[model samples]
Target: MTSLTVDRPTTFDVHSPATGTVVGTYPSHDELAVEAAVDRAHGAATWWRTAGFAERARRLDRWRAEITRGRDELADLVHAEMGKPRSDAKLEIVMALEHLKWAARHAEKVLGPRSVTPSLLTLNHACRVEYRPFGVVGVIGPWNYPVFTPLSSISFALAAGNTVVFKPSEYSTGVGVWLADAFARAVPEHPVLQVVTGGGDTGAALCRSRVGKIGFTGSTETGKRVLAACAQRLTPVLMECGGKDALIVDADADLRAAADAALWGGMSNAGQTCLGVERVYVHTDVYDAFLTELLDQTRELRAGSGDAKIGPITMPKQLEVIRRHIDDAIARGGRALLGGLDAIEGQFVQPTILVDVPEDSAAVTEETFGPTLVVTRVATMDEAVERVNDSDYGLGATVFARRHGQAIADRIESGGTSINAFVAHATIPTLPLGGVGASGFGRVHGPDGLREFTYAKATTRQRFPSPLALTTFTRSAAIDSAVDRLVSVLHGRIG
Candidate 1:
């Protein structure tokens, strides 16, 4: 086991939230080191892509088994680095394994060749589309839900036959290294996956690398910078940026279930999730009842380092942002039914709920990536829907209407929506996961995810000659006139 060290930063500490003691120090990688790793990955990807779908699937299955067998050890590493509860960490690992398995099983069907009908003009030639792997893929991951988010990109990329170079968030670099080690053991013959540990500079280097594509999950502001960096090389990107997602409650909705889902979805991992529910819109008929239930569930959430209901905020800098959101909400006349700005201590921010906050307040319009939520009352379902769609970020949304759940969900302009549940669509394993507008673009789940790392190649084979010859230098004026008449009869109408 060679200790991976670089000339960049020597020692960055990871502190234990439970004890506030330094736990570990990670070595950071420099540009030269990152480029070398990507260079190796490019060669490996060429070989791996040529191995065909069956061989890649077999390798992925073996990797999946290895991950399942060592799930506990891996979960422990995640818990130590990210300060998440052991159970939650285990759940993240399990979901990542599920994604790995799903990608392997479905890649062939999703990315395989398909025949398409040629236009009448080109009927003399046959046409088909085939997906080709991008040589190397670069993944910049987030600390919150570290395993699930990064693997969501990497698994799909690998399944599509691209090698990966991942730069995990600085807070969870150890866990990222562990994942790469596991993959190396499972597929020692090829360096198909590698981890580069560092802060923003390393991420920037990766964006500027010669990789075929870049997938990033982080704040919208940083996502903009990443897009700018990747633009230098004209590289394509799949960015899962920040989201201030909303949950709509109709007049006949179930308040208890909605409250439970909202509380968990908003406060889990200290609300560090990109798709966490940050806003709630409820009809005035059950507004009081819904708010009461939501506060009750929220007050019971305890943040600590052990087997607590919630963990500390993974990044230290986020605490200030959380405090500012609460302060802005309070100054704008929003009533704090639960916790307030002072509730944020160090890395842990107790669950805070604000009501009566103006729509123009920062808490309502901005991405408050913390354990705080804004609740507002609406007179009708249409108003609720309108309010939810007003934000620029449209990552994930929830609808709690029994009769019109699907209809309401379809109306929301978001990447994904759950009917009567929160974050349930993420676990379904068959739907696309991403957002529209400022929430960023591209997808990292299901068939869309499998295709994100590959380019479509259209192949046309000329077979027998057609009755009327075209695409030849010897074509006659008579043939051109006949083609025009045929097209007019087939598609034209006298308007």
Candidate 2:
């Protein structure tokens, strides 16, 4: 919660989490600079939206190719700044590319004008609905999955014909710059995309600026501050916040597959994922076997410097938070099957799995953005489902069951639920992705994502004169009686 400070002014240094070396330096921007960038973005949006969906699609296709052509460079920036493994970084970019492709290819079909059936009372009129651009959008991205998170909003906004001003996390400003620079190369005519680098000050400024919409990806606490700041201008915001997602295993589940998913889901990306599995609920029938397999598979995973399957924690300060959570779990009578409090060392925190952790303990209740999971046993699937839904944060959940996977998934309160797997549902382009309750409101993927950046406008055209012109002031008592008779004739039950 402490604010970012600096002894050196004018610019800030981005330190590598894996090694304390300075990876990059970016200009420390201020409110004035943010206003200017938003102004330029809005000006470009004037011409960009007019280009229509086809022209925008062509430009976006070129942008997508540019990203693909230099994917290595982009992925490297992510690894260097965020300390995620190169392969993991690549997966993030590839997933983002899928979203970009979907936004571009399907924008016209989902957002273009489409006719709707006229009501029986107004049959003489024709109605059509279309979506329009929101002009300028400001995207404040996170350090983890830098390219993927911000691009989720930027790609959709651009495909819907809106210009963007992006402010990536201070930890990954270089990646943000690279993305904007690539956008410029694709469309050289306009400043359709711009980057302003700084800490929270710059982001707060963007929220208060004249942008029509703001898309933010970060913690739930930060999301509230952003929302309150945007309220000054009444600017609509899209918030993708924190989550304490749960993975459930049933009695008849595939034990091997469930173990693999539990380990990967809980420990991947150093457990700094919003949809990471923080809690596990397994039926007591297979609890011992499942835990044996989970711990056995987890032994192969390591979090340390160089060539490790998992990398260092991206944010340096999260080390203490992780340490405290592990300690609290132990103090509350939890047994560490894999790792204990001593697991945290500087930027690296080894994978830790706790058993019998109390439900009210901080480790089980809070978003421990670390490589940890709290596993517990339940008597039945109903108890598992009830326990998972108990969290205030419900962004996503994974259900692993042979006979009741879909049924279990249907009852969860998150935006996206994967059956027998964790996070693969996101790969499907048509599934709307977001969260419910404290996880966040509004969606950011599929048809809903394309429409999220635009406003809907409905049009009603006169196809012919209406027989009962009830809207006109020139109507007589006889016309009113005729309308009443027509309504009665259409709906009267012959009793």
Candidate 3:
């Protein structure tokens, strides 16, 4: 007779995807732990909300300085945890810091109480509206961008006067702890920002807990599950999900510039970016030239651990998905101008460029979050716009045209469109970033992002008595008639 036994680990190990070495180990927090973190956040939120914008801004500035001083250390940690190039990790930190600064500097003017004009019918009353914090917010982050994506939500929520209980991706648990520790160095008074490290169960606990709002970044399928779990508690959620983003190259577009942007946008971060360029639609007139340039640029790129142009895929399981997409594309008659299935070498996926890919193929329609790109030829600019708009994902799009750049960008169906550039919207602090359709909804940057964690508080006060008071119990018939006449006079003009 034989017997077998299995044991579950209470503390899970985080391994570097590039090296297959354990980088850090963290406790897998259960539901109760998540609830406790939320409780602590609630207490912190009360003080944080009352601290006034000036005080919060001061503290945030200190936090920024702390991060700046420790930028290299943090970037190294990010690289170790998620397998991104140190330089790329540093860039994410820089962008995230910029967003933090913008949120701190603009919070008061954006969310502070402001007077609004009273309606004619309510002329005797003064009206004002303000955005109030939602107390404690729960943020479930992603691994692809361990720092930037989560900080985009966390900074805005904090600036809007809410404390955040962050559940960082299990793959990036170490980086999440580093972020919390950095904030503590700046503001040690309260646990204004905290991290709970774990996997799906931990995130589910955060969602089910009594947080004011939730900000989630992941795949559309996982986002749907998060939304469903939040539904049980009726918790409001801001979803930042997946994207099958596209880049269009017009006939008059600069072949060199478009090719350069496309190569970087598609291959950076190993093409794991939610807004990364997965599909490139080029006008038939210049398709060959653009392809030539893109291939030349892509060929010079290499994927490896230290000092490589492209880093290894952060999630091991994602390698299989990438391979599946590549195989499916080749089977569907797509020709690989660059690397194909062979590009996915262990954890490292070398840059791949595929041409003649069908619009309905998985590589084009689904999100192949790897260093792979599928370029398709279009008959005209109109055809390019139609094909880009036909995707299930509408997160972002880019248009490259000399004369009709703006017009082409305006016609693309996406949450944001970049003209003659790739992902320029994400770099700007004032622009909101999110997606539409299967890409998910709710923005996480700009003014809209600040308000996503708060609710509008509207107030009205009587400045003086109304001559025709209509709400009095002792209203006379003559006064009612006068009110009716006023309403008719105010709104009776025929169109």
Stronger candidate by TM-score (2 vs 3)? 3
lDDT preference between candidates 1 and 2, better one: 2
lDDT value, residue 373 of candidate 2:
91
Candidate 1, position 298, lDDT: 72
In model 3, state the lDDT of residue 115. Answer: 97
Write candidate 3's Cα lDDT for 1-495 as tens digits.
000112353788999998899999888888877887888888788899999998999999998998899999999999998899999999999999999999999999999999999878789999999999999999999999988999999999999999999999999998888888888888898889988878999999999999999999999999999999999999999999999999999999999999998998899999999999999999999999998888877777899977997998988888999999999989999998899988878899999999888889889889999999899999999999999998889999999999999999989888999989899999899999999998888998899999998999999999999887878898899998988998888889758
**Reference-based TM-score of each model:** 0.97, 0.96, 0.97
Give lDDT per model, in order: 0.87, 0.90, 0.90
382-462 per-residue lDDT for model 2 (tens digits): 999898898899899999999989999999988899999888777777888788878888889899998899999999999
**Which tens-of-lDDT digit does each residue in 248-346 have in candidate 1?**
998889999999988888888778788889999999999999998987777768787668868887777777788888898899899888889777877
Stretches of model 1 off by over 4 angstroms after superposition: 1-9
- In model 3, the Cα lDDT at residue 79 comes to 92
Clashes of 2: 0
So what's the TM-score on candidate 3?
A: 0.97
**Model 1 TM:** 0.97
